[model samples]
Structure formats: C-alpha cells, structure tokens
Target: MVRRMTMELAVDVARAAVQSCRDAGYQASAVVVDRVGIVQAVMRDTLANRFTLQAAEDKANAVILSGVDSSEFRLNRQDIRPEINQIEGVLMMDGGVAIRAAGSIIGAVGVSGAPGGDKDEICARAGVDEVQDRLDFAD
Candidate 1:
C-alpha cells in the first residue's frame, strides 16, 4: 500500500506543533495536510487569533502545492507568477514544512501565531521531528 498520513498521526503532528509553539513562549495554531494537500488536522491554542488557523492551513497547502517549504516560497515570492499567488489555499510564509516519508512527500505541517515567522517555522519543524521515526520506516 502507498504510504499515507493517518488521522492519528495527523493529530500527533498537530499537537506536537502546538506544544512546540507553547514551549517557545507563544500561543499558536497548527495544521496538517495529507499528501494530496487535504487538511487532516488543525489545532489552535486558546489565545491564538482566529486567523492563525487559516494561516496555518494556507502555509501547509502551499508546501504541498509547491513541493517546497513555505519559507523558500516567501523568499522567492517575487519571482513567482502572480497567477500562482492568486491560487486559493496558498500562502508564502515561513511556518510550513513538507513532511517526507521514504523520500516521498507524505504530508506537511504548518504553525502560526508565534512572534515571528521563523519562530512559527521552528515549532513546525519540532512537530516534524516528533514523528521522524515513523517517516523513516515508511520507505
């Protein structure tokens, strides 16, 4: 069977991201998307802004759509087609990261509500690291 993100794993990823953000002294939101870019889970800290969830989802969607971390997109957004920017569910930000399993893009994790985009990205990366073992064995 093709490797795919499970609902349980999605929640684990989301929760881990939120916890990471909290540990980093921020109330944040996190979202996880499947390989197809479908949202699988979302979590928001009580103090996080309402928009944070949407932002997280957009970041994750962008990673899946572009096959690159959102930070890279943000850095090169000027060179990207304006039409690409118009696509719904795309956000050029630093908090989204692609989740790979056995060299295949299996999903992504995104975080928002940190003091800075880099902080948000750090939390998202923590989430990915939380499940590194699972990803490694998926090949």
Candidate 2:
C-alpha cells in the first residue's frame, strides 16, 4: 500500500515555506501538491504579488508532472522530456520541488513572487528541507 501524506504534514510544510520566504525578505506564495498534482496547502504572504498563487500552483504542477524539481526543468529545458512538459498545468520554471519520503515521491512544494527565480527556488528548498528530517523519521 502507498503511504499517503497527511493534512497536518502539508500544513506544517506550508507554514515552514512561508516563514522561510519571509526570512529571506521576499513575500511569496507557497503551494503543496500531492504526487498526482492535487493541491494540499497554499500559503500567501500578506504582501505577496497577486499572481503568486497561480505561479505557485504552476510550479508544483510542473514538478509533479516532470518528476523533477522546477529548477531542473529551468536548467535543462532543451533536455526535458516532451511528454512531461506537455502536461496541462506544468510550468518549466523555478521554485518547485518534489518531496520524497522513503524513496517515494510524496508531494511537491512550490514558491513564487520573489524578485528572482533563484530566490524563489531557494525559499522553496528551505521550506522542503525543514520537514525532510521529520518525513524520514516516519518511515
């Protein structure tokens, strides 16, 4: 049986992501999506750009569809498999990360609205890493 992520875990991850972005002085929106691209949590800073929500969702979708982080997609655009990129909601940009636990993809986290894509990616990574140790313990 596949181990499913819980809502509490999703909420914790989202809050951690928001805090990480705020600490970096960048207001952003963070989204968490299940392996199948279903949204689990969405957090937007008070001062974040209005489009942050959509951008975050797009990033998460991209990671889920491609089975790789959004930064990888951005860095390897030419090499990205066409079938993965063709997913309806996927966005080949930065700020998305796939969450893996026990060697299985559990979800994805996406951050957006930062001044630069790299900054967004950094914040997203920080957030994901925050819960990675706990996730490991659950195995």
Candidate 3:
C-alpha cells in the first residue's frame, strides 16, 4: 500500500524532461511532484525564463489535484468548475502529466518555457518515458 516517488527518480525525471526540451531546441524548466502535490525535484535550464519555474510547478500541482493530465483538463476547461480555477497551484495548461507506477499515480511531471504548451507536454512525456522501466507494473 505504500506509494512514494524516490528522490533519485524525481531528479532523473526532472533532468530528462529538461533535456528533452533542450533537444527540441528550447530552454525550459521542469518540476516533479509526489502524489500529494508536494514538490520532489525542480530543474531550470540555463536560459529558461524565471516564470517557467512557477508555471511548471502549477502544471504539476494541477495534475495532482485533478487526478488527470493537465493537458486533458486544458482541453475541457470550459466544463471545469470555476472554483477549480481559483484554487492555488492550479493551471489548466497542457504541460503536466501524471506519473504512474504499478498502475497507480505516484507523481507527476510538468515542463514549461517552451514555445507552446504542447511542446512543453512533449518534453514532460519524454521525461516520464525515461523512467518508465523503473515504474513497470507487475501483472
């Protein structure tokens, strides 16, 4: 029943996410948060905008709160309760994705500072993919 994201994994995820953005020819920031929305790791590229840090954190937090990818929420934003928008650390953006371990959400990764939200999301997914092996579920 125990579920948690290790510090090593968190750092690895964050770093890989940032690297993905870099390889895509963008400088960005990436944040990794445990299931409770508590930040576990953060990384900002050398030239990333200062706001990218908060953007990344908010994106990840939004996923944790909604239990859905932030991109999914972004697509259905019009149907979302207005009160949800008022919550702190919630951003209906496309850059956050849930991190599943053993078929359960263990954490999330969010990337920002890309030219577009979709680009940020792409980098975030790359980060998760990098660690997928460690999170494989036993059938």
Candidate 4:
C-alpha cells in the first residue's frame, strides 16, 4: 500500500512555505506534491510573479521523480540536467524538499519567486520544519 501525505498536510506545508518566503522579504509561491508527482496543494503570496506557481510545481516534480531534494538532484546530476529539464513538468532547480514520513518520502514541497534558488530552498525547508512533529509521528 502506498501511503501518501494528506491534502490537509499538503496545504499546511504550502502555506508555511509561502509565509516563510514572505518573512524573508520575498514574494513567493509554494506547491506541494504527492510521492507520485501529483500536486496536492498550491499557495502563492500576493504580488508574486504569475509564473512562480508553475516554477514551484516543477521543482516539486523534480523531487518526486528523483526521490531526493530537487537541489540535490540537480547538483548531483548536472550531466543530465539539461535533458531532464526538457521533459514536461520537470525542473531541476532548487526549492524542493522531500516530505518524509514513516521512513519514506511521502511528498515534496517546492517554493519559488525568491531572488535565488537557495533562498527558495530555505523557505521550502522552513515549511517542512513547521510540520516536523506531525511527520515524525506519521504512519
């Protein structure tokens, strides 16, 4: 049985990610996706660029497809990064963090619209940290 994170959790993560980015003085957006790369929730901060939403989703897809953080995948797989990015919905960029529970990656959180991918990744991690307690006890 494939145990996926709930939509409620997905929404919470997305909200926290966007808020974290806002607190960091960046108008950003966040997208959460299930393990299979299906979007579970999305949230965008006001004044954020319209394309940020798609960017966030693509980062999350990168994580889901790689079973690792998007940034890590990109860093470790630069040889194939360009080719991978050619695929639809695959963005080998930063700002994607794996959402793990029950000893496995249950989903991922992606953030974008910050000045840099590193900044986006920091906000994405903050979102996952916001739900650390729940993830630790997840089934």
Residues 62-120 of candidate 3 have per-residue lDDT tens digits of 89988889988877676774667678888778899999988888999999999999999
Poorly placed runs, candidate 2 (over 4 Å): 79-87
Which pairs clash inside model 2? none
Model 4 Cα shift for residue 55 (angstroms): 0.5
All candidates in order of TM-score, best leading: 4, 3, 1, 2
- Give the per-residue lDDT digits (tens) of candidate 1, residues 1-139: 5989989888999999999999878999999999998989999999999999998998898899889889887787667746666888887878999999888888999899999889999999999999999888875
Residue pairs in candidate 1 whose N, alpha carbon or C atoms collide under 3 angstroms: none
Q: TM-score of each candidate?
A: 0.93, 0.90, 0.94, 0.97
Instruction: List, residue by residue over 1-139, the lDDT tens digit for candidate 4.
Output: 6887998899999999999999989999999999888999999999999999999999999998999999999999999998999999989999999999977999999999999999999999999999999999976
- What TM-score, to 2 decimals, does candidate 3 have? 0.94
Selected candidate, larger lDDT, 2 vs 4: 4
Residue 137 displacement (Å), model 2: 1.9
Worst 10 residues of 2 by lDDT: 78-87
The CA root-mean-square deviation of candidate 1, after full C-alpha superposition on the true structure, stands at 1.4
TM-score of 2: 0.90
Q: In candidate 2, what are the lDDT values of residues 48-87, reduced to their tens digit? A: 9878988888898888877889888777776765655576
lDDT of 3: 0.91
Stretches of candidate 4 off by over 4 Å are none
